[model samples]
Structures are given as C-alpha cells and as structure tokens.
Target: MSFLGLIGCDNGRNIRSICKNNPEICADLHKDSWCLAEKTKIIQNRYAVKDSEVTTGKQLYIQLTDLEDYSRCIELASGVQHIIHTERTADRARAFRLSTENLSVLQEQTRERQDPFMSYYQWTRFGDTDALNRFLELENTGEVSDPFLLAQAATYYSNRNAIKAQQLYLKVFAEIPFDDFDVNWLLGLASTYRQTQQFDKTYMLTKANLLLTQQKYSEQKMLALLGGNKLLAAELDLKAQTLIDSLEDASYPLSLVKIWLESQAVAADIKPETLPVHSDEK
Candidate 1:
C-alpha cells in the first residue's frame, strides 16, 4: 500500500516536513489528498460532536456516549501511521488527533516479550534507590534510554530539591521544547528562587513570565518596582490606568484602578498618587 493511500498525507507543513524527512516510511504518494481530506472530515465530525455535547447536552450518559465516540475517532487516527506520514506531506489541516493506542499496544507487546530474569531483577531492585542509581548509571553509559528516571528527577526538584529540579527541568526542556515547560517547570524555578530569597532571579522570572503570556498589566509591576525598575512600574501603571478607563462600566473601571493602586501600595510601598496616572484619570 502507498503510504499516502494507507493514511492520507495532506495535513500541514509539520506533517509534510516529517514525510520529507522520512521518505522510506512515506514512499507512496498516490491518492494522498483524498485520504487526508477523509481523515480531516472524520476528525472534524468527532470534535463537533464533542463540542456540542460539552455545551448543550443534558443527559449525562449521552454526553459520555459522545466522548467515547470522540475517543474512538482519536484511536483510529493514531493507529494509522501511514496516514500520519501522508498528512505530513501537505499543508491541509492544523488539528488532528495523535493517538496513544499504538504506544499502548507496543508497550503491552514488549512486556509480553521481556525476559523473566531481567524483570525479576528490576522487581527486586525497585525500592532500592542506590541500586536503581547504579542501574541508571549503567544505562547512561550503555545504549538504553531512561525517561522514567528523568521524570523522577523532575519530580524531585519540583518537590523543593531546587538544584536537582533545575538541572533536570533544563535537560527536559532542551529535549522536549514544549509549552508545558514554561507553565509548570519554569514556574517551579521561580518559586525556588523566591524560597531562597534570590529576589533578583525571582523578579526576572516573574517578569519574563508576564511578558511571555502577554500579560501587560499584572502584579509584575509591583515586583518590578520592588526590584528597582521604577520607570517600568510607572509605565505599566499608566497602561493599567488607560485600560481601566477604557472599560464601559464606570463602577468596575474605578474599582479596578483603586484595587490596583491599593495592591501597589501594599506590595511595593508605592502610594496611589505617586503612580503615573493617565491624562484621562480625573
């Protein structure tokens, strides 16, 4: 079967790049567009059902029924790797389900094929941290990959073991390049800095996070002022004032400005009148 025929390829640039990079897997390109379109339709239908059920559906059982259908559609998509390879060859769809079915199946098969002796050794060494460390060292020196150990290291650092967590989170960020890193792990780094009274690092991280999320007016202004960026605090405070004035509801707008001004005083020792008010602020 042509790779495109088996899975459909006309998805988007990422998939196209993947197909181009792995020519061996996506060797056949005939009828690729049709398959991609069909898959796309299936996925869209599934999501439509899911969205409808989430918003308007009343029957709990019926909502669950829709969810099950959505899950099955996802599983079907994941099982067809040829389709995935095909989808990579074109710029068609932005969203598609990446299924875990194949991974689960492969894991089960590997477990079935594993040597009992090695399994026994692992079982016996399970709770022995030192022995596990020795095994991990051996794996590091050898060919085996140790994702679980890496995850454990991240957990350890997240649990107040700052040094270990920083190292592991950095390593994982390098390998994974995911948004979740910024959300959870990097936030942990900021927390660690705060705990250690590393005010500079904490301020830097908090400022970076606010900028990254495009949060123009936030408590970061107070942090920035405390960290000696008076100009930035004034600018942000002015922007906040403008945003508050732009709100249609006068009551909420005034309340928001008062709340922010009060928060600034309490958090950064800056009084309300000292803040830079926009020209429109009466």
Candidate 2:
C-alpha cells in the first residue's frame, strides 16, 4: 500500500537525507540506533521499488523479505534497556511493532497471488499447499524463470528426489549468468550427483564451486576424491573452468557445459526421474 510510498516522492538524496526529509518514511523507524544494517537494506529496497514504476513481483517479494528482516532484527534490538536513553529502547520497540504489522499487511495483500515469487513467499511463510502448487504449475508452464526461485525448488527436491534436484540445478545454470547466481547451486548439484553415485560429476561440480568461490580445500582429500588419478582430476578441473567461462560469457541455453553434463548422465545410463512421489505431490 502507500506505506511503501515513503520513497515514492523523493528524487535524489543520500539515505539519511531521504529519511530526514521524508518524515512519513522514517517516523515509525528507529533513529539510527539499532538494526542499522537491516534498516539500511529496507530503505534501499523501498527506494528501488519507488524508482521502478513497473514494479515486478520479484521487487515486491524482496521488499516483503527486507521488511521481515528488519522486523525480526528490531524485535531483538527492542529488548535492551538504556537508563540514560530510555527513549532509544522505546523507539526500537515502536519500530518493531510497526514493522511487524507492515510485514503482516504486506503478506496478507499478496496471499493467494499467482506470481511464482509471491507464491514462494506464501509457501515458505505459511506452508500453504495451494501456493506451492501454483508455483510449480507456473514453473511447468515456463513462467517461473528467476534463478533464485529455481535454485530453491531444486534444493527442495534435493533430499527427496535426487534426479529431479539435479535437473533443476542444471536448468538454473543453463538459464542464468554465472555471476548472477550463488555458488551454492553448484554445491547442490554436487550433492545430487553424489546421491546418485555419479562420482565424477560430483567431484567436478564441487570443484567448480570451490574454484569460483576461491575456497581452499585439502590436497590430500581432493586427491583421494579422485582416487589419486591426477590426470582425470586435471581433466575435470578443466571442464569445470570451461563451464565457468561459458557461464561468465553468457554462453548458455545450449552451452557446451550443459551438453557435457548431460552426456555424462547418458553415458552412465542415468535416466531422468520426476520428484519422488510424496505428500508434496498432493
């Protein structure tokens, strides 16, 4: 609602200036005392929403989550006592109260909405089965294309359905830019590969994530993962680098990396499987 319009009227100003100039925006918020990090993010995202005349569902979803984050943070910050500055704590408590209510209002307004991003929020926040179904239906119809949502659904299947998780993870990589995505998706694919005994693939994906994140690993453990086959390890590392290069260059949707991963699955006789039949199917 117009509560989000705090930034709708401002043109160009620093965050503090925006708040100081627009009493409507910062009146209910704590005055630069607590939850500063979350507060900054909330204001920034609201500014983004206000600046975008055509606010996508993703932007709204982000605003919802940012408010949620600020609410939770301030809720904790509201508990401390300040003998000399008693009003600071009171201010935080008020901010917490307002943020919590705003978040609830926002959620209520978006509940039962058909957008995949909003459905994701409803499903996660309320465990709404219908929201989940709507999300998956949109996904199946090729409307759920955001990389974050896709990776999350891939993760949702990881523990219950290895093949399905693997497919979804690959789809994420195939569809989004490398830098725009989290390396954790790479680790998700690695875990899926391991679950199905595709050891080579497991190592390759894990290596790719490690390489991209610049995370260090144990040489002994790494060597053992490949059973001391230095040549094969080198080859897989090369493949991983090639995959990263392709993604960085926007060379996907039919990238050689996808072809390589799929060919390996075929070579191993791994058949694609839908999610394991479960209560989720209902």
Candidate 3:
C-alpha cells in the first residue's frame, strides 16, 4: 500500500493529490500533520522512518499556514530529547504573526525545561564564568539529556566571553543542522567571528546568510543583510543596487524604490544622513 493510504480517507486524498503534484510539498504537508498527531503511528507506519521523524514533522508544521495545527505541532515538538532544529524552526516561523500562539507555546516549553539544561543560579548568570562552569559540568556529568546546553553556552559566549562563545557556537554549529536555529544566531556568530578576527569563518557564515536571503527575500532578508556582517552587507548592497538600477528604467514606484535603496545603503554601512533628498518638484 502507498504511504498516503495510511493518512486515512479524509487526509489521504489531500496528501495523495499534493504528493502527485509535488512530492516535496506532499511530504512536507504529511510531516506537518503527523507532527501534530498524538502518536507517530501515521508516520512510523508510512515507510522507513528516521530518528528525525519529529524533526521532519516540525519542519512541515513551520511551513504550514494553519494556526491550530501549527500550535499543536509546536506543543508536540517541544521538550523532546532532540529538538535544536525544531526550536529554530519554531523561532523563525513564530516571527510571523500567524504563528504567534505557537511561538508562545514553544517559549513556555523552554521556560518549563529551564532547570533541565541549567541550574537556577546558572540561568541567572547566563553570560558569566559560572555559566561556563555549569556547561562543562553538564558535559562531564555523562547525562546527554539536553542538546540546547550548547545553544545556551553559545549565547553566553557571544554576549561576554568571546573566546568561549566562539568555541561553543562552533560546537553547536557542527552538531545542529543549519535549518535548526534563528537567523540571529547565525548573524551573531558571524559577527563574533569577525570581531575575533576570524575572517574566514565570518565570510563563510555571511555567504551562507546571503544564500538564505536569496532563497527567501523577505523583511528578514533585509534585516539580516543590514545587521553589520560586513561580508553579507557588501554583497546584498550590490544586489540591491542592481535591483534599484533595474527598477529605475522601469515603471516601478519611486517611493518603494527609495525604500529599497535606503535599506541597501544601510546594509552597506553608508550613512543615511548623507543620502540625497528626493525632490518631488519634478
């Protein structure tokens, strides 16, 4: 029997149709629905299911538009033994107003699981030496329960302890899939590399962010482009200029064009104060 057959009659048609038209899309939808289902029977019975079954489901839910389903998916994905990807996916999706409730659930789950990764005192000094000691203690304790310990360590390192931050971020970066964290972490890590004079790693991360921006050119792209990663800013600035030049010769809105150009300038580190005022006297 086909995998879609197990999704049940009501869902099977939709899943099969979506799969027939676009297999990737169908897989994503199926994964999202399966993530919300209390049991993994729908997914486990489908075919060869990987250990990342929950992770796959979370990815699908993050791409979905239904608030109710998205919320359920977040709830199910939270506090799992493995969830770096799920956390990042939920964080990015929650940036959209449609997924606010799901974001809230994820945050609540994180709060509930706080002491599991860090002690109450360690959480207080999240960016201090004590936190580092706690992280090392966790690593040495031989209880690999929470993967987000690296994430917390990276955050602390990025904030106050540059050397520690770079090491922890690199460790977390290696372990978690690229799609498993917010863009800010990537941006911060890139900036940290740049500040520590690790230009090569900075350039690599910046290029990665650029490619991601190209893949989805939304407001997030603009923010990522302008957020002080010199390499990404330089590249996006050129692209934005090319776009503006193309628009200039066409029938594009002048105001919108101005906004794009201004944003590009900001990304490129050009002072907005020096920008020429557009006169409507024409």
Candidate 4:
C-alpha cells in the first residue's frame, strides 16, 4: 500500500454513521432508548477528534461540557425503570457510571487550563476563583466575544458588579438580535432598570421578553414597578415593539435602542422617573 494512497480517502462525519463504523466510540454509552440527544452531541464531539492527531483546548472544553450533560441526563434516565425490558434501565445505569468517571477525569485535567472558554467552565462548574480571575482578565481585553459566553459573564457580574454586568449585557445585545435570544436576560435587564427607577425601560425590556417567549413573568408586579401608570406602560409598549423589531432584524447595534441602553448607564444616578422616558436598560 502506497502511503500516497491514504491522502484521497474520505470518511463520513455523521454521528450515527461514525458510531456504526466505530463501535468503541459509543460502546460505553447507553443505546438509543435513553438520552439520545445528549449521546448524539457527545458522539459528535468525539467523532470530531477521531482523525486529528491532537485535540485542541476548545475540543477538550466541549468534551467536558458534553460529558457533563450526558452524565446528568443518563443519571435521570437510569432511575426510570423500564415498564417492559428492565435491561434498558441497566444500560442507562452503566452509562451513567462510566460518564461520571469520564466527566470527573476531564474536569481534573482542565481544572487549571487558562483558555477563556475553559476558564469559564472551571469557574462556573467548580467555583474556581483563580479560573474566574483569568476569565475576567480575558473579558476585559475584549477576548470573550461569543454571545453565549458574554451572557454568562454578564450573569456572573449581575450580582457582584452592576456596572460591569450592564456593560457585558449591552455587548450581548449589540452582537445578538431577538431571534433565538434567551429571554431570561430580559428579566435581569428589567430588574436593573427597576433599580434605577427607569420604569419605562423596565417595561420595555420586560414586554420585549413577553413578546418573544410569552413566559409568565408576573405582569402585575411589572406594572407596580411603573407605579400603576398603565398610561405610561401602554406608551412604552410600542417602544418595546420597536426594540423587538430592531432585534428581530439584527439592527440593534445601530438602532436607537442601542443608543438608549448606553445612554441610560450615564443617567443611572438621575432622579427616579416613571413617565415614558425612553432612555435604556438592555
């Protein structure tokens, strides 16, 4: 066999096909009867490394997260006794056992890794302050650009440093639009406005969330934040729709909404106002 002949060979990267061709990749995992989504993601991550001679730091991070998810899902799956074939339960139990050890080993290996995303993982998962410091340093240099990571950073700062949290979350909105956005952040942003007594903005952010997710976020209390000023709340509702429109079309960074969010931080110390003042919150 000529060594040159190996260069033209191609292997499918599909998770199911990869699992079918490489038994050991998924041998320790539970069968399709349980945790299918989690197992698929884990197998996909694993398959990405099959041909690479060395996995990158990002790969290790993703593997760690995937294993954590699979372990958690399978742990729950293992407890649900099968009504028909109890062997299914046994399979999940074995997978849970293996996954627990695998996650622990990976966590230990990356506990001190200094990369930004991995540092975030360590800080959030293990409460490692040293890792958190590294992550914050990277964040300060604007290295943490991923929307999801920025959201996590914003949430971490929300309780400790209000100003930093506001800035980080502003970056999140700058980079992301309404499509597929996490609505929980809206509640956080809304509360921030309530603290500053910018009731109109609080209503805008909250209403935007309700528009997207229709989640039950206690509208009555939100009205109370506005001092029962339904007239003001009703006017701000249109602003909320405008914010959603901008976010929906990915025009938020240049839209008035972005300007408003930035402008409000400067005016945070201004007197409390419940009337329809269109400054910003999130």
Candidate 5:
C-alpha cells in the first residue's frame, strides 16, 4: 500500500530520515508492517465474523450463563494482552473476562495506590449487571479528578466506547508529560486518537514512541552495529524481537509503525528484502 493509503499523511520524509539513521527503528517498522499486512488479509476473509457476539465486557457478562466455569477459563488467560487483536470473538471475550477477573483479585490484595475504578471494571467484566449499575450510580454522582483514577476510568471505556475513551484520554494526556517514557497510557491515548480519526495526534504520539524507544536502547543497538556491519541486520532483528516480546501488546505499536513506515520505506529507498541474499540463492 502507498504511504497515504496506509496512514493518510505526508510525514514520509520525516519517517524516512529518522529510520535511516536508526536501524532498530527500521527493523521494528518492517516487522510491524508485515504483521499488520497479514492482519488486514485475515480481516478481509469472509470466515472472520463481522461482529463478536461476546466481545464486549457487557456481552461476555450476559453470555456466560455458567459464570463459574467461564471464570476459571478467564483466570488461566489473565496475562494475555492484545485481546481485541484476535479474529475469534470467543477468544477475545475470554481474554477480556480473564483480565477483568485477574484485576479484581489484584485490587483486593494490594493496598497501594489503587485505581478508583477497580470495582467498575470487575463488575462490568463478569457481567454483574445489578452490581455494576449500583456502583455506577454511586461513582458517577461525583466528579473524578484524580489523574490515576481518571486514566483507569478511561481505560474501562476504551474499545467499548471510543468517543468517551478519547475524551478521557485527552484529559489524561494533558496531565502527563509529553516525554513521560511510559508506554501504557501514551499508547492507549494514541489508539483512541486513531479510532476517532485524529490522525495528526496519532502520528505525533507514534513518532514520540519511536524516538523514546530508540533513545532508550541507542547504546546497546550501536554496540551491536559496531561489532561488524555484516552482523548488524541480524543483531537488530534479534533486538526488535526482544523488544516486541517485552511489550504488553506489541502488535499495537507495531501496527502504528507499519502504517507510517510503509511510505517511509519507499521514500528512503528501503527494499522489503532487507536481509543479505544467500550466495546459493543468488
């Protein structure tokens, strides 16, 4: 796809220049772009369901007629990220349910800086309809000004209600520094911006993430490159994989990078086949 087709922007020059100097960024962009391309193909398949019956917290709560059995399943998949990236609605629902249940237990055990909206998330996830209504009734009556609480509340509404989520994220963004170096909230806000068609904001946040990541690991990446130009590509690829694995949901940022880099790669004259061809193959 063309640059405009992928990210609907003219930031190609900036992307190309930055990525050329930063092979780690280039490698990461390539991986994410490929994954996103595959995801798009999967999404275009007819067998993929148009709407997940139980994808949302509310829907899962209602569909899990046997709460105990489903809850057990949720417990098992508690740490799985990218729940929404699945092609299967059932899988997505299961992951969401597990996350909510896990959070519920963790909230009870810890007495530290607790997210004020823990009850809200827990009740919504398990489909405790009556309880959720009661909690919302009490919680919504007052204005929530706590930065941590507002961010958590925003996350609760994320994906389920995009507009509301965007609003909450915007508020939180104002409170947080631009150079926070924290991935969680920044990424969340960027997703909301993209969903809301705020492409400029999305591009800015995505670029910031790239710059932050590059700066953070510049020393290590440079050392690998200096070892030998011959091993640089392989070394960068390994580092990218390690970084992707460390993320809660690598695909999210990867998708963003893929979109921007699709065009950037072209502008920089970067061919898709970055690896050195084998002598036998050649």
Candidate 6:
C-alpha cells in the first residue's frame, strides 16, 4: 500500500489523531526528514511527538529539545552551529524562548537573554541517566568555568563517581570559597569525602560547613564519619561517649557506634559531658 493509503488502511487513524493534535508534526513532515523520523517513532510507539521542522534556528532548537532521544537531541543541537547568533531577531528570540521555557515553562515568563549553557544545564537537570552520563562526558571535556556548572556536575557525580565528584567540589570550594559559595555543594563535598573514606577531610569540611550555615546536619552520618577516623576518635572517643551518655536516646549510627564503644568501655575511659556541642547541632 502507498504511504498515505497505508495510513488509512491500518494506522491511518493513529496518524490522523497525532497530526490533528500536533499540527507541527504535519508541518515538519514536508520540511525535516529527521522530524519525520521522530514523528514516525511517535506513531509506532503511540507516543506524542512535537510539531515543527528544522528550517530556522528556532525550529531546530525546539526539535532538539523536543526529542526524548538524547543522542538525537545532541545531534540536532550540533547541526545548528550558532543558534544564539541567528541573523533574524525572531529566530534568536524563539531559540532563547524554547531553551528557557524548558528550564521553567510557567514561571520564567520574561524574555531572558540567550544563555549559551542553558541547554546543557537543562539536559543535566532533567535528562535520564544516559542523558546525564552523556552530559557529564561533555562537561568533563568542555571548559566549564562556571561555578554553577561545576557544582551541578559535582552533585550529579556525587553518588555515581565519588572521586570525580570530590575533585569537582574541591575545585568549586577553592574557587568560590565557603563564605560566598552554595552550602549544598559544601555538604555534598563533605559527604563525598565521607563515602571515599577521607574521614579527616569529611570532618574538617563538615565542621566548616556547620560553622558557615545553620542548616541541619545528620547526626547519624556525622557520628559515622567521626567514628571511622582513628585519629579523631582516639582524641575525642571520650567526648563522643560523653555526648551519647548525656542523651537519653540516640539514633541509629550514633547508637550503633556508642554500643560498639561501650563494648570497648575499658579502653575508651569515657568522660562525662566532655563533647563540645556546637551552635549548629540539632
């Protein structure tokens, strides 16, 4: 059967429904072969594909972001060499609108300036694991000088790749410093250090972060970090024992560590109320 004939014969109703709901799909069929391929998948998968072609920079921008396939999105983005600098002001405006709209479609109503990093940032924030991983590769290779990007990359890698995440966090901390930096990144870096068995660094960073911000710290996680540090534990073992002793009921990690320390009670020589509670302690 012919293409249009086959639509009516078997999948015609499905195609009709998609085309009716998304006129852009119909519009792109004549202009963009890639758009047609994506639209065909929507038909075959019974998922909705966006309308529009890739004739102008604006259309290309929409097409890039509209696709769920990360590789295709990157391919489409690469096809448009300089989308922000399109000769037509309307094209440039449309590109900016599409990119920023993806960031926050409802709240960011104001037409903001074209951000070169917006697409990458959006991919990093909202994309699936594969997309995030791909974006991480791009982030590693690119000259990502922006502190926000570095922090975001670090956060994304915080669980997946502790070494890379710690390195990125250290870079962010060193460049921006705590007094002017995002507290979340500091805590994240501390957590990364904790995960990688860098107890001293974790304690130092966590203590510094507590001093900088009044945000709640997880007592269990902190105690676990301190408990693993032989140097700190040797000097402050009595202090930790005293803190738990003062508390009527302690939580898991703290309780667990306290129990273990109690088993070593003779060796610990625990002191009473010796641990210094900080202003930030919960």
In the range 162-272, model 2's lDDT, one tens digit per residue, is 888887888888787666788778788877876777766776787888788777565545555566677877998998888788778878566777887765452243332
Cα-based RMSD of the predictions, in order? 17.4, 7.5, 15.8, 6.8, 23.4, 18.8
Which candidate has the highest TM-score of all? 4
- For all predicted structures, in order, the TM-scores are 0.36, 0.76, 0.34, 0.78, 0.31, 0.39
TM-score-based ranking, best first? 4, 2, 6, 1, 3, 5
- RMSD after Cα superposition, model 6: 18.8
The per-prediction tally of clashing pairs is: 7, 0, 1, 0, 0, 4
Return the candidate ranking by lDDT, descending: 2, 4, 6, 3, 5, 1
Write down the worst ten-residue block by lDDT for model 5.
269-278
Which parts of model 3 have CA positions greater than 4 angstroms off? 1-147, 178-183, 215-282
Candidate 1 vs candidate 4, lDDT winner? 4
TM-score of decoy 6 = 0.39
Clashing pairs in 3: 157-165
Model 2 spans > 4 angstroms off: 1-13, 51-55, 159-163, 175-180, 195-197, 211-228, 241-258, 265-282
Local accuracy of candidate 5 as per-residue lDDT tens digits, 3-106: 23434433344344334554443331222222333222222221122244524322222223223333444444434444565434445444446535643554
- Which residue pairs in candidate 2 have backbone atoms (N, alpha carbon, C) closer than 3 angstroms, thus clashing? none
Task: Give the range of the ten consecutive residues with the poorest summed lDDT in model 3.
Answer: 270-279
Per-residue lDDT for 68-162 in model 3, tens only? 44446655454343355575455434433334554455434443232324342334423545545654566546442343556665676685766
Better of 5 and 6 by lDDT: 6
| Global Cα lDDT for candidate 6 | 0.48
